[model samples]
Target: MTFVIDRYPCEESPRLGAMILLPTAESVPRARRWFRKFIAPYNPACSVGDCTLMISELVTNAILYGRADEGWCVRVEWFREGTSLRVDVHNPGFPANVRLRRPDADDAHGRGLLLVDAIAESWHSGPSAFGGTVVSFVVADAWPA
Candidate 1:
Protein backbone atom coordinates (compact mmCIF):
# COMPACT_ATOMS: atom_id res chain seq x y z
CA MET A 1 0.00 0.00 0.00
CA THR A 2 1.23 3.53 -0.77
CA PHE A 3 1.23 5.82 2.27
CA VAL A 4 2.14 9.48 2.45
CA ILE A 5 4.02 11.04 5.31
CA ASP A 6 2.09 13.99 6.65
CA ARG A 7 4.04 17.21 7.05
CA TYR A 8 3.28 19.71 9.74
CA PRO A 9 2.96 23.38 8.83
CA CYS A 10 6.33 25.10 8.40
CA GLU A 11 5.45 27.39 11.28
CA GLU A 12 5.17 24.37 13.51
CA SER A 13 8.33 22.41 12.74
CA PRO A 14 10.56 21.15 10.00
CA ARG A 15 10.86 17.46 9.36
CA LEU A 16 14.20 15.96 10.31
CA GLY A 17 13.91 12.71 8.42
CA ALA A 18 11.67 9.79 7.47
CA MET A 19 12.05 6.16 6.52
CA ILE A 20 9.89 3.24 5.40
CA LEU A 21 10.32 -0.16 6.95
CA LEU A 22 9.00 -3.54 6.00
CA PRO A 23 6.62 -4.89 8.61
CA THR A 24 8.74 -7.58 10.15
CA ALA A 25 10.42 -8.51 13.43
CA GLU A 26 13.78 -7.36 12.09
CA SER A 27 12.50 -3.85 11.58
CA VAL A 28 12.53 -3.18 15.32
CA PRO A 29 16.31 -3.11 15.55
CA ARG A 30 16.57 -1.44 12.18
CA ALA A 31 14.31 1.34 13.40
CA ARG A 32 16.51 1.86 16.44
CA ARG A 33 19.62 2.12 14.30
CA TRP A 34 17.96 4.47 11.85
CA PHE A 35 16.69 6.67 14.67
CA ARG A 36 20.14 6.88 16.20
CA LYS A 37 21.78 7.78 12.91
CA PHE A 38 19.08 10.26 12.01
CA ILE A 39 19.53 12.11 15.30
CA ALA A 40 23.30 11.81 15.54
CA PRO A 41 24.07 15.44 14.73
CA TYR A 42 21.68 16.57 17.44
CA ASN A 43 23.38 14.58 20.14
CA PRO A 44 23.79 15.88 23.72
CA ALA A 45 20.57 17.83 23.16
CA CYS A 46 18.45 14.93 21.98
CA SER A 47 17.87 11.88 24.15
CA VAL A 48 18.98 9.28 21.68
CA GLY A 49 18.66 6.31 24.04
CA ASP A 50 15.12 7.14 25.13
CA CYS A 51 14.01 7.98 21.61
CA THR A 52 15.50 4.78 20.29
CA LEU A 53 13.66 2.73 22.87
CA MET A 54 10.35 4.40 22.11
CA ILE A 55 10.80 3.99 18.38
CA SER A 56 11.58 0.33 18.87
CA GLU A 57 8.32 -0.22 20.69
CA LEU A 58 6.31 1.73 18.15
CA VAL A 59 7.87 -0.12 15.21
CA THR A 60 7.27 -3.47 16.87
CA ASN A 61 3.61 -2.65 17.32
CA ALA A 62 3.34 -1.60 13.70
CA ILE A 63 4.77 -4.91 12.62
CA LEU A 64 2.67 -7.01 14.93
CA TYR A 65 -0.72 -5.30 14.83
CA GLY A 66 -0.68 -2.81 11.98
CA ARG A 67 0.22 -4.81 8.94
CA ALA A 68 -2.28 -7.40 7.70
CA ASP A 69 0.35 -9.11 5.59
CA GLU A 70 3.82 -8.75 4.12
CA GLY A 71 2.40 -6.47 1.46
CA TRP A 72 1.89 -3.58 3.88
CA CYS A 73 4.69 -1.30 5.15
CA VAL A 74 5.40 0.95 8.12
CA ARG A 75 6.51 4.57 7.93
CA VAL A 76 8.45 6.45 10.58
CA GLU A 77 9.02 10.16 10.59
CA TRP A 78 10.70 12.64 12.92
CA PHE A 79 10.45 16.39 13.18
CA ARG A 80 12.20 19.17 15.04
CA GLU A 81 9.50 21.13 16.86
CA GLY A 82 11.07 24.14 18.52
CA THR A 83 12.85 22.84 21.62
CA SER A 84 11.22 19.45 21.31
CA LEU A 85 11.32 16.51 18.92
CA ARG A 86 8.29 14.67 17.61
CA VAL A 87 8.30 11.17 16.15
CA ASP A 88 5.50 9.41 14.36
CA VAL A 89 4.92 5.79 13.42
CA HIS A 90 2.30 5.11 10.79
CA ASN A 91 0.74 1.77 9.93
CA PRO A 92 -2.37 0.28 8.39
CA GLY A 93 -4.11 -0.57 11.64
CA PHE A 94 -7.13 0.51 13.63
CA PRO A 95 -6.43 3.69 15.56
CA ALA A 96 -8.68 2.72 18.43
CA ASN A 97 -6.71 -0.44 19.05
CA VAL A 98 -3.61 1.46 20.16
CA ARG A 99 -3.67 1.83 23.92
CA LEU A 100 -1.72 1.22 27.12
CA ARG A 101 -2.60 -1.92 29.04
CA ARG A 102 -1.63 -3.13 32.48
CA PRO A 103 0.40 -6.15 31.59
CA ASP A 104 0.55 -8.98 34.09
CA ALA A 105 3.88 -9.77 35.72
CA ASP A 106 4.06 -13.11 33.98
CA ASP A 107 3.08 -11.70 30.61
CA ALA A 108 6.09 -11.44 28.34
CA HIS A 109 4.41 -8.87 26.09
CA GLY A 110 2.09 -5.84 26.02
CA ARG A 111 4.37 -3.34 27.72
CA GLY A 112 5.30 -1.29 24.67
CA LEU A 113 2.87 1.60 24.98
CA LEU A 114 3.38 1.58 28.73
CA LEU A 115 7.03 2.47 28.26
CA VAL A 116 6.12 5.22 25.79
CA ASP A 117 3.66 6.78 28.24
CA ALA A 118 6.18 6.80 31.04
CA ILE A 119 8.90 8.50 29.01
CA ALA A 120 7.34 10.77 26.41
CA GLU A 121 6.46 14.33 27.35
CA SER A 122 3.23 13.92 25.38
CA TRP A 123 1.73 11.30 23.10
CA HIS A 124 -1.46 10.34 21.22
CA SER A 125 -2.76 7.98 18.59
CA GLY A 126 -5.40 8.61 15.94
CA PRO A 127 -6.48 8.04 12.39
CA SER A 128 -4.08 9.34 9.79
CA ALA A 129 -5.34 11.76 7.12
CA PHE A 130 -3.81 9.64 4.39
CA GLY A 131 -5.30 6.46 5.88
CA GLY A 132 -4.57 4.06 8.73
CA THR A 133 -3.35 4.88 12.24
CA VAL A 134 -0.59 7.22 13.31
CA VAL A 135 0.93 7.06 16.77
CA SER A 136 2.98 10.08 17.71
CA PHE A 137 5.02 11.23 20.71
CA VAL A 138 6.95 14.31 21.67
CA VAL A 139 10.01 14.74 23.84
CA ALA A 140 10.13 18.18 25.40
CA ASP A 141 13.31 20.22 25.69
CA ALA A 142 14.94 17.99 23.17
CA TRP A 143 17.27 20.76 22.14
CA PRO A 144 18.59 21.70 25.50
CA ALA A 145 20.35 25.01 25.95
Candidate 2:
Protein backbone atom coordinates (compact mmCIF):
# COMPACT_ATOMS: atom_id res chain seq x y z
CA MET A 1 0.00 0.00 0.00
CA THR A 2 2.32 2.75 -1.26
CA PHE A 3 1.57 5.92 -3.24
CA VAL A 4 3.30 9.14 -4.22
CA ILE A 5 2.29 12.22 -2.29
CA ASP A 6 1.41 15.29 -4.32
CA ARG A 7 2.65 18.61 -2.97
CA TYR A 8 0.69 21.71 -3.96
CA PRO A 9 -0.27 24.86 -2.17
CA CYS A 10 -3.98 25.42 -1.69
CA GLU A 11 -6.02 28.54 -1.10
CA GLU A 12 -7.27 29.58 2.29
CA SER A 13 -10.03 27.20 3.31
CA PRO A 14 -12.97 27.71 5.57
CA ARG A 15 -12.66 26.60 9.17
CA LEU A 16 -15.64 24.27 8.94
CA GLY A 17 -14.83 21.10 10.91
CA ALA A 18 -15.67 18.78 13.78
CA MET A 19 -13.87 17.14 16.67
CA ILE A 20 -14.32 13.94 18.65
CA LEU A 21 -12.60 12.75 21.81
CA LEU A 22 -12.09 9.06 22.30
CA PRO A 23 -11.10 8.12 25.83
CA THR A 24 -9.95 4.59 25.13
CA ALA A 25 -8.43 2.43 22.43
CA GLU A 26 -11.72 0.60 22.08
CA SER A 27 -13.24 3.88 20.95
CA VAL A 28 -11.13 4.16 17.82
CA PRO A 29 -13.70 2.38 15.68
CA ARG A 30 -16.37 4.70 16.96
CA ALA A 31 -14.31 7.64 15.69
CA ARG A 32 -14.06 6.02 12.25
CA ARG A 33 -17.76 5.29 12.20
CA TRP A 34 -18.44 8.89 13.12
CA PHE A 35 -16.19 10.15 10.33
CA ARG A 36 -17.99 7.94 7.82
CA LYS A 37 -21.27 9.50 8.76
CA PHE A 38 -19.68 12.93 8.79
CA ILE A 39 -18.52 12.69 5.20
CA ALA A 40 -21.59 11.01 3.74
CA PRO A 41 -22.98 14.37 2.64
CA TYR A 42 -20.04 15.16 0.41
CA ASN A 43 -20.14 14.30 -3.27
CA PRO A 44 -17.89 11.48 -4.48
CA ALA A 45 -15.11 14.03 -4.90
CA CYS A 46 -13.92 13.36 -1.37
CA SER A 47 -11.56 10.42 -0.99
CA VAL A 48 -13.32 8.51 1.74
CA GLY A 49 -10.92 5.61 1.42
CA ASP A 50 -7.81 7.64 2.18
CA CYS A 51 -9.50 9.49 4.99
CA THR A 52 -10.60 6.26 6.62
CA LEU A 53 -7.20 4.59 6.30
CA MET A 54 -5.34 7.59 7.70
CA ILE A 55 -7.80 8.02 10.53
CA SER A 56 -7.30 4.42 11.61
CA GLU A 57 -3.53 4.65 11.47
CA LEU A 58 -3.36 7.97 13.32
CA VAL A 59 -5.78 6.91 16.02
CA THR A 60 -4.06 3.56 16.43
CA ASN A 61 -0.75 5.30 16.93
CA ALA A 62 -2.26 7.61 19.49
CA ILE A 63 -3.67 4.69 21.46
CA LEU A 64 -0.68 2.40 21.26
CA TYR A 65 1.82 5.12 22.12
CA GLY A 66 0.02 6.99 24.84
CA ARG A 67 -0.38 6.32 28.55
CA ALA A 68 -3.81 4.76 28.80
CA ASP A 69 -3.63 4.64 32.58
CA GLU A 70 -3.42 8.42 32.70
CA GLY A 71 -6.79 8.88 30.98
CA TRP A 72 -5.10 9.90 27.78
CA CYS A 73 -7.87 10.68 25.36
CA VAL A 74 -7.26 10.72 21.63
CA ARG A 75 -8.74 13.80 20.04
CA VAL A 76 -9.66 13.35 16.41
CA GLU A 77 -10.50 16.31 14.24
CA TRP A 78 -11.18 17.06 10.58
CA PHE A 79 -11.63 20.20 8.51
CA ARG A 80 -12.79 20.85 4.98
CA GLU A 81 -10.97 23.36 2.82
CA GLY A 82 -11.89 23.76 -0.84
CA THR A 83 -11.40 20.18 -2.03
CA SER A 84 -9.08 19.04 0.74
CA LEU A 85 -9.50 17.38 4.11
CA ARG A 86 -7.24 17.83 7.10
CA VAL A 87 -7.27 15.11 9.72
CA ASP A 88 -5.60 15.48 13.10
CA VAL A 89 -5.11 13.10 15.98
CA HIS A 90 -4.06 14.53 19.33
CA ASN A 91 -2.74 12.31 22.09
CA PRO A 92 -1.97 13.09 25.70
CA GLY A 93 1.68 12.21 25.22
CA PHE A 94 4.68 13.60 23.43
CA PRO A 95 4.82 12.85 19.74
CA ALA A 96 6.48 9.58 18.80
CA ASN A 97 9.84 9.71 17.08
CA VAL A 98 8.40 9.14 13.61
CA ARG A 99 10.67 7.98 10.84
CA LEU A 100 10.62 5.69 7.85
CA ARG A 101 12.07 2.30 8.64
CA ARG A 102 12.86 -0.57 6.34
CA PRO A 103 11.26 -3.13 8.57
CA ASP A 104 11.92 -6.78 7.84
CA ALA A 105 9.11 -8.82 6.39
CA ASP A 106 8.98 -10.73 9.66
CA ASP A 107 8.28 -7.51 11.52
CA ALA A 108 4.62 -7.27 12.42
CA HIS A 109 4.66 -3.54 13.23
CA GLY A 110 6.40 -0.17 12.62
CA ARG A 111 4.91 0.81 9.27
CA GLY A 112 2.15 3.22 10.33
CA LEU A 113 3.95 6.51 9.63
CA LEU A 114 5.37 5.06 6.44
CA LEU A 115 1.89 4.39 5.18
CA VAL A 116 0.80 7.89 6.25
CA ASP A 117 3.71 9.58 4.51
CA ALA A 118 3.05 7.61 1.37
CA ILE A 119 -0.63 8.50 1.27
CA ALA A 120 -1.02 11.96 2.75
CA GLU A 121 -0.43 15.05 0.62
CA SER A 122 1.35 16.61 3.61
CA TRP A 123 1.72 15.62 7.25
CA HIS A 124 3.48 16.80 10.40
CA SER A 125 3.51 16.49 14.14
CA GLY A 126 4.28 18.73 17.11
CA PRO A 127 3.30 19.74 20.60
CA SER A 128 -0.44 19.76 21.04
CA ALA A 129 -2.14 22.91 22.34
CA PHE A 130 -3.56 20.65 25.05
CA GLY A 131 -0.14 19.78 26.38
CA GLY A 132 0.63 16.59 24.46
CA THR A 133 1.20 15.89 20.78
CA VAL A 134 -0.82 16.46 17.66
CA VAL A 135 -0.25 14.56 14.43
CA SER A 136 -1.98 16.01 11.41
CA PHE A 137 -2.23 15.36 7.68
CA VAL A 138 -3.99 16.88 4.74
CA VAL A 139 -5.62 14.87 1.95
CA ALA A 140 -6.01 17.16 -1.00
CA ASP A 141 -8.31 14.91 -2.96
CA ALA A 142 -10.72 14.41 -0.12
CA TRP A 143 -12.75 17.50 -0.87
CA PRO A 144 -15.58 18.29 -3.21
CA ALA A 145 -14.63 19.58 -6.63
Highest TM-score: which candidate? 1
Q: Residue 131 of candidate 1: its Cα lDDT? A: 74
State the lDDT of candidate 2 residue by residue for 16-93, as single tens digits.
445455555666676677777756654436567777888888888887776545545677766776678787788876
* Model 1, span 25-130: residue lDDT tens: 8788888887787677655375789999999999999888884533778899998877889999999999999988999999999999999999999899999764
**Superposition TM-score, candidate 2 onto the true structure:** 0.78
Indicate the TM-score of model 1: 0.87
Clashes of each: 0, 1
Candidates in order, TM-scores: namely 0.87, 0.78
lDDT of each: 0.83, 0.70
* Native-referenced Cα lDDT, model 1: 0.83
Candidate 1 residue pairs that clash: none
Native-referenced Cα lDDT, model 2: 0.70
